[model samples]
Target: MLDRLDKEFAFGREALDVRAYRQELLSSNIANADTPGYKARDVEFSSALAGALKQNGTASNSSTLKMAQPVSLSTSSSLAVTSQGHMSGTSTLAASGGSTDDYGKLAYRVPSQPSLDGNTVDLDAERVQFADNALHFEAGMTVLSSQIKSMLSAITSNS
Candidate 1:
């Protein structure tokens, strides 16, 4: 059924989303390379993907895969309430953006060499990471395409 297709394609879809998010982070790092005190940031891809899938119950139970809601790393919430006090007043919300529970959360990168300006971005490293992520994103697309073709072929031949 279509539900099965959803489950089957979920991994590829999720991987693609994560890859795109990583690309964005890397691009930001590259763009801010010259900004004083701007720390380079990146997600731990595999762990982030795993965490996202787990949140959706996709990674743990194939039986529940069809019911699982999709989770995207790139579009995750950056702002959240710090306490009930924030929710008490309608005028303004006291929120925090430093949650460790964030899916595909960005982590500060360690520079190979320290800079006097306190910037942690290494242009060479960010560029290399960006290139690698772009390659993986394309590769994920290819795999997804293959899966779709196989599914379509099966359906057409059956009909």
Candidate 2:
């Protein structure tokens, strides 16, 4: 029953998480606009959400027991560790600063107008992205809330 609930909401859950993470990235870019060579960073939302869905097994093979199980990246053999002492990819990203370890796929934003300080962050672009992402995040929250409310109403009616 719990797994069913998880699988049902996994997509929306992951979508919200990615949106929030993107918000952070955009905010960071805007905040560091004056920093030299900061290089604006932002995540590709569709790709990130798709990857998360695959990890959650919600995008494919939903009937399998693996659905809703978190994938262990440490066990992935494709990852090449330069040194035994080196931290995992997620931890490394978190340690570097802003972005979380989840969906460690931030892309550098291309600047429309080059800056003398070498900073790629465009204030106008960042502001627009931030607002758009925030709106999406709020919409996701509302949808999730509505789904839960509907479920509760159904359960209560049956009781």
Candidate 3:
């Protein structure tokens, strides 16, 4: 049913959302590189993706069991701030095969060269990282779109 589709696409959807968030954060950092006390922030890409995967797995498993009021798969991870001011968050998923723990959730890269005013935005590095994140975001979108198209085609053919 529609619920299954939503669960199946949940991982990709979350990835796209996180990617957009990262892009925005990176853009803000680049725009305020010269601003004092502006700490550059970004989510840990690998962990976020892993968390999404875990959530999907958990949801699917819960669905099969017919549990009354299945646990929400959108639980947010704990935030961890490193000594250098980087923040990390974790997301977990429960699955039939096994549970997945997504370490390194949301984290900001500590600036290699901290400004005297405590600013951590490195113009060059932020720009490069932003571009890379954008590329991955676009790729994720493409994959999701293709999957949707394939599913629609399959449904239409059957009808």
Candidate 1 residues 1-159, lDDT tens each?
A: 766777788787667767777787799899998899999999988997787677666787554333323442343335457987664333432212112243556799988997899999999988889999999999999999999999879879956
Q: Report the C-alpha lDDT of model 3 over 1-159, residue by residue, as the tens digit.
A: 756776667667667755766676788889998898988888787776666555545434454211223234545777667677765656653332212233235566787987899898889999899889989989998999999999889889955
Q: Please write out the lDDT profile of model 2 over residues 3-92, one tens digit for every residue.
A: 777766767777877887788789899999999989999999998887766765668856522332332334323445799897655322
Please list the Cα RMSD from the true structure of every candidate, rounded to 1 decimal place. Answer: 8.3, 7.8, 10.3
Model 1, runs deviating above 4 Å: 62-102
- Which pairs clash in the backbone of model 2? none
How far is 133's C-alpha from truth in model 3 (Å)? 0.8
- The global C-alpha lDDT for each of the candidates, from Candidate 1 onward, is 0.74, 0.76, 0.68
Residue 157 in model 2: lDDT: 100
Cand. 2 Cα-lDDT: 0.76
Better of 1 and 3 by TM-score: 1
lDDT of 1: 0.74
lDDT of 3: 0.68
Clashes of each: 0, 0, 4
